[model samples]
Target chain A: MSTTISPKNAVQVEASAEVKAVHQQMLRQQRLNRAATYAVAILLVLWILVPIYLIASMAFTTPAAVRAYPKGVLPFIPFSFETMNFFLQSEGIIPGVINSIIVAIITLVLSTLIAAPAGYATSRFLFPGRDFYRLSVLAVRAFPIVVLSIPLAVVFINLGMYDSVYSLALMHTALALPTTILVIGSVFASIPFELEEAAQVFGCTPFEAFRHVVLPLVLPGIAAAAVFTFVMSWNEVFAASILTVQNRTLPAQVLAVLGQSSEPYQFAGAFFMMIPALIFIFFIRRYLFNMWGQVSK
Target chain B: MNEEKQSTQKKRKKINWAPYWLILPSLIYLALFFIWPMFRGLGLAVYNDEAALSLQTEPSRDAATAGTLPQGTQVEILDQQGNLIPPDEAGQANVITEVWYQISAEDADGNTVEGWVSESRIRVREENEAGAPTAGSVRTRIGAGDTLTEVYSEPNENAEVAGQLEARAEVAITDQSILEIWYQVRGEDRNQTVEGWAQSRYIQVFGETNTGRIDRGNTGQFTTEYLSKMVNDRFFWPATITTFLLMILIIPVQFVLAIVMALVIQARLKGNSLFLYVFTIPLGISELAVGILWFSIFTQSGFLNSFLQTTGLINTPITFLSADTRYWIIIAIWLAEVWRATSIVMVIVVSGLQAISDEVLEAAELFGASLWQRVRHVILPMLKPSLQVALILRTILALQVFAVVIALSGGDVVTVLANETYRQYSEFRNANVAAAYAGLILLISMGSAVIYLRMIRSQEEMAA
Candidate 1:
């Protein structure tokens, strides 16, 4: 074979072998990278999920299950609805959950209504007080609703509106307004101004252009803003606790009755409050950056 | 067509009335709800609301407060606002006005300190005030956080003990002896109506003072008593400092975690969005939910202790949420907050990272720069704006921290300024101090925001 093989052929065969070895090494490296990626992804997923799993386990299992010396992380033990049923059937909880929904809805509507225009104004046109408006939105961050709710409580009482969902909704709107305005403004800004201009050139009035062209484009962002506002209002405790007496939101009610209830009720209540939030978070995943990223830019 | 188009154009081409109109609703709402209330809160904090009546700590005319209502003493006011509501009926007997304050408040903070009237002198406002309780029956304010344990089945001093009653649980007396040392009482607790024999001497009995305490009224928005309560409230300084510290501590750590998370998610790997979705799932959970969920882990006999005990780490389950180890409660709360809110920073960082052009990174790599060097010189500088935003927002939100602590601590052993503000209004019935606390929080939050804003600005942006 050595006699039959020319030196050039031998050299070519050696080069081909080298190329095949290099290709094999690259494939192995790629597989290693992929394995690393999957490991990290799984680790992160578990990190995010394990707490939720523990909570869900507690909520679904019996009180004894929670007290188990070695607590089970998963809901593998026979499921029991007794805790959740008791919480759901409890007198204060139903109205509380409903009031939370109502308050959140009101917050969403009010924040969106106020923020959309304010945001649109800031995004579309530069006015004299534009910087002031922008800075003030940032400035509102300085004051917690805790401080504001005190005076608002008094005012709401004077207005004969204290301890009602409306007063609470109003406070929530104020809290939600700053972020809504900023987020929605950025949303509108991201849409090309040329789109609205194009609509106007085609015989649409400016308002008509916004209503038809700009609005549909910004709806998803607005929806995201609405979700954020809803989550905020739903989760809010301080203002709800302060501003209302009889008509308490879920978090406020939970705070009020926290000590009185048993542990199972606590877990159930906590898990119950999370149900709507879980659903909404899935809806708003794409818009989180749209909501938060604009601030930094 | 030309005329109509010209006319429409003329109407549209004028000053942009649109933006101002668009912004009006927000301005009006803010003015009505936000700005006005903030100003009023600050103003109300300084002004001493005229006392509906001057508060007398001792029920005597010397007007000495022997100082505020003594804890555990109860007052049955024939009239709460003796003469405040209807000035025309000043000093006159109008016994029907409602007592807006609690009837049997055990907690001193929950007690509205009107003026105190000594025993037997309460009906002195009138020859026979209709407001006085019937001859034998008496009102009682339970002592703050005191458990009325001896629920004897019989009225006798030594009877079979029934199940005990909880704190702040109240009852009406059906029968009692002189000085009411032992009384027959009944009250409802959750599912059952409880009848029990209790001793006035042992239990925290608040009411039936010969003279009632009157809250002249919150005439002076600022009262010395109110100020003292605000300063001295158990939760005041501790909560305030905790809130400040928690925000300060968590912001840096949260930023680090967020960056790592952002880096991980930005790895150009498949299913990275799933990571984003999972990580930010917590963002959706309310503070109440997070706190409660974590509480199950940290409580005595909870998951952590359970795990510890199972692993033979200790002889007994540790009470992590107990007042003796309240610092651990704060740590648990910090854990819950970090777990729930770090994603907010992560999302912002990811957005910032996403905005960075890969070309620049490749160029930096092309310059023989190491990953650390490139990250320091390029990535960090560009990520500054995002970090600043996350820092400012998180700090502001953290300063307003309320629900998490409430869920974990149950308003005991731990408190924050926001929680104190709530206590001032709801528990103490003092809105002025509540406002002041809020104002302080606002000042701090704004100050922090200003610091972050100034500190993190890029040189070019700062120069410009």
Candidate 2:
């Protein structure tokens, strides 16, 4: 085709040159699109980093330095852990942190335990009321914990279980359960049923097949669900506040004492509360897309 | 063949109920915790009244003969049964009783009069002197201005001009003050009857004229002052409402920002992988930490004003924590929330985004489409299913927003649904109204879910 075009008359060769120019213009536009993408990337990074920088600086500053008006951009004085120590020594901080960890763990375990098999059932079984079950889970997911927590508080009081960590865990489980079910259901659905059927052919029971074949295949998805549930439970405050008073969670304790203290103590408390979540998020960053995709769909 | 068919039918009857068993715990938990409490709370809001528990009443015959209650009465105590004993008097027989009863009466025009009726005036029905029915009736003394205040009246020209003519006219005079008489005359030439201070010399007394008298005490005016007093008495109750308003202000803003971030990330732009990681970092940060972070920047002597001053943007450092600057603190918290929560949305959206087949995009690209055209026509439509889920989840979470706001604002400028519930359970020690607010939140969440379902259905139809 190139040889044929080369031997063409002068007027026809001019037409081919015009086509080449159009192709060059398309190339230029593609290059411009790439530049625009980079610009967006840069802007997004800056948008995310600025607040983080502010928080880090505040967490590190000394009490006097933090209180000083017109604080220098950099920590002008040497950073100290005095604020953090103050928070650690404050009333309810240690217990609150411990309670938060315990509640989150229990919530993670219970939600995963209940939601996994149910999620699997939802994905695999062609049962009656399947759609209803899915819709009901969605409805539960939509029910505000604030509204639910108030009534739950009363009920707990009546049952003589108010202000207990167990109640907090229960409420947290309720909050995280819907997402767990949905994510695991989607994860299970993505894995072929044929694998389970093949296990059945090897003389395994239905339960055994699921335990070996389906569970192993969906482990990544389950881990993602666990992480999501943990973060949710960790971050939760309203229900925790309403549910527990003496045994407050970390967020609740911090919140209860917010703005009541010196700037350094407040910053230190905030910084400490955020650390676990940040570390957890970093480790599980890759699964975020998968987890979100499953939940959203 | 018949046996084989029968055995197959028998085997089919043994269906697995394990799924039902699996969901049983959650179902039981919901039924006991959510559904039951909801109905109970609703009952309290609609039916129960703490004030009504103290009210007591006794049976009576004629409305007028029932008691000696006068108009415009104010007393601290109602009828005390113990105070009804007769005093020693009247020819060695106890005739005077000391019963104290709160009596309220209203005239035909609906103006209420209320006062304490003495036990002596309240005569119990007894057999007549000759076995006929008999009951005691008290004649109330008219005071100054005690007559019906003339709301409206018609004038009689002949009566005003000293003509001795009978005219159908309405006259109202109170026992307290007959000096000010209100008269409405109905005649051929009727006009408004004016109210004036009548001279005592012009008055004529008649025995039967007061026969239709209404036994009433002075009814207090329902003034703005009284209403305000009532509200003050129940000030703790309204705190729930304030808390709800605060929650509404903070939660939805965070939710919107979060959803937007999620959607943008899910758009599958280049370098979103790194962005997703960055966004998730705030999830690890505690609400207190997020608050402190923003506080560091905005406090009077913090980073923000310092930066501005160093850059010569301001003449002096500004105080950000003052009462006046607290509103800006709320905005800073909002930014913190956006930073913290957008990752959640991003995660949800990205997952949803991935579920969309690449083939769909390929098909659109093959059809000679621009990137915008592909996103508008191909991606968004496919994203609807996920968007609905995201919206429902985000809204529920948003309604319960507390920690971030509390941490950031130190519970000063920010109040929310969750915060109000906390205040009720903690500060005021009133669980009932707090539960009521919680119930309101539940209603909102359920309503949103219903709307979401309707939206998703319509979107589905549109897609189809």
Candidate 3:
């Protein structure tokens, strides 16, 4: 609202003083609001990142420094891999990691395989029981893990499948299936149904239409769902601990001895568990909404 | 016309079963793993394993004793001596006579024992019955008692007391008394090969075979003792109250913080996607790791203390995770939960915010509404459904908070429902009590969900 009162136009100045002052006040207020927003946003970013950074420092530092009081916030002065290395070399760590990876892979395959067709059916077919199925899936998605794991553990043991990685994968699949179906269902819903119809009209069979036109578009979202399934299984500790004895997953293994483990082992173990998740989220950052958002709706 | 009418009738009669077929596997899987276990957990909460069978050497009532089998023991029927009576229209007794079967099974010592078990003693294992205890894997705890549990060399009370083991000691079932009153157990001593016998009543037999999940009694009779035990536990109220308190404290703060973060991203400022990524980073992190990460911060000589000391805000590092500082432990857990979980809420909120079209916000801006007014009037109302979803999600998860409390506070100073459930299941070897805790948690979670649903529905009605 600033008016130019140059010498040539001095007799023709327009904007009132009150209006200029009000405009200036409004601009200042907007600037203040922007600064506040940035401040809050950056503070939140730090809130999430700083703990991770602190744990990472503890992980990368020498074991001696990890135990020292008034510890350094950063690991740079004499960064050492000693702590993380010690954790990795420790008994059962390798086996635990192997078990975690296997279980996650199995869970990813099983959940995605089982949920894909269901997701497709719900999104496309408009079947009679579709709403009931979808609502139940939604309900089951929020089921407490404790209730499911304890009994399933008993069931697995009865079937003589307990303490095996795949048995755990089965349990993890059950946990992830509901969310997977909902997410993949929404993914399918996003693709236009007429595209599949057009492919069929062009002489592609229904299956051929699905395999060629629709599959290519939805594959990434389904893969993201699968990756999340893997992450869920990888990050889960309670069920893994309850369901398996010898075939403990990484989180369960770390938790099993966390009470007796030293500070370095604990920190390094936490950092190790967090690494895949951090990277996985980075890759699937585009589908964060696709995975979680539509489910909320 | 007749041909066309017939064809139309045929077309009308046919039903599409393709979608049903597509969803069948998932439905069955949920039925088995989700629905069945929930009922099984409920059953576990209500039942205790208290049934046993005495194996007679002969079919006669006066026969000599051969061995004993705990309920749920798998035995192969070698011979039968009586007819199976059918239930009549009057609903009379199904067994007309005392039936007996000669059965063979491996004993606790891996030796096969052959004996006559009466029909009344053995429940028929249904064709679809899941696997039973493989004859010798019974692990029981010495039930609560202050006095030392005296173990006899023989099943008889007159037999010499071989040793006295401490209460709450775990023992493997090596043998059982023929009279079904005592169990020969191998106690905690490592060097002792031959352990002694303890009375069955003093031995608390939770249906945990050596290598399986906790099972309720195979006898199929329900009991309220486990549920009562959970309710009567010393830590029950503290854990329950703390669980709810944490939920109450954490969820609102989380929603607010999440909304702010969501708004920041929605502001479309420079590098907001980077901010979105940073905020959602914790969505991938596990609760156990989050607990450990925060433990590193709040531990003695940890990051928080280090920072405070470096800045001269404190002279010495505080013992934040100790028993005397229980509130601090709770705070540490609160902070950890907030840090780890708010991201989920933020993502949901951001999506909800995105669904609000730009024109509505522009309309509000053109109407000269303040930022606060726009959020209060135009934004939050639109965000209700998302908020409801986030609230329910956060609350349910908050109830099940386990490792964070344990990791930060050692679970001694502060406890939650899930921790108590784990303690009952793993440490105490009491599956029934653990199931009780799990059932209680589920109940509360469902109650909260129902409440949230109703609240939102009512609010929507009010607005309508």
Candidate 3 lDDT, B19-131, residue by residue in tens: 99999999999998899999998888886555434445554435654544454443333332322233242143221233333344444444454434333333343222333
Which ranges of candidate 2 are over 4 A from the true structure? Answer: A1-16, A75-77, B1-13, B47-272, B283-288, B321-330, B362-371, B408-414, B452-464
Q: List the residue pairs that clash in candidate 3.
A: A154-B213
Residue B324 in model 1: shift from native, Å?
Answer: 2.6
Pick the TM-score winner: 3
lDDT of 2 by residue, B37-142 (tens): 6676654433322211111123111122212222211212211122122223322321222333333344354555333333333333434455432332233335
- Reference-based TM-score, model 1: 0.73
Q: Put down candidate 3 lDDT per residue, A1-297, tens digits, no spaces.
A: 235547535544444666788789889988898998899888988888888888888889799999987886555446989999999999899999999999999999998989999999999997777898899999998889988877887778778898999899989999999999999999999999999999999999999999999999999999999988888899998888888888798999998999999998999999999998889898887788877787677
lDDT of 1 at B131: 47
Better of 1 and 3 by TM-score: 3
Query: For candidate 1 chain A, which ten residues in a row score worst on lDDT?
Result: A67-76
Looking only at chain B, model 2 earns a TM-score of 0.53
Task: Supply the global lDDT for candidate 1.
Answer: 0.72
Give model 3 RMSD, 1 decimal. 12.1
**Top-scoring candidate (DockQ):** 3
The most accurate candidate by lDDT is: 3
lDDT per model vs. reference? 0.72, 0.62, 0.79
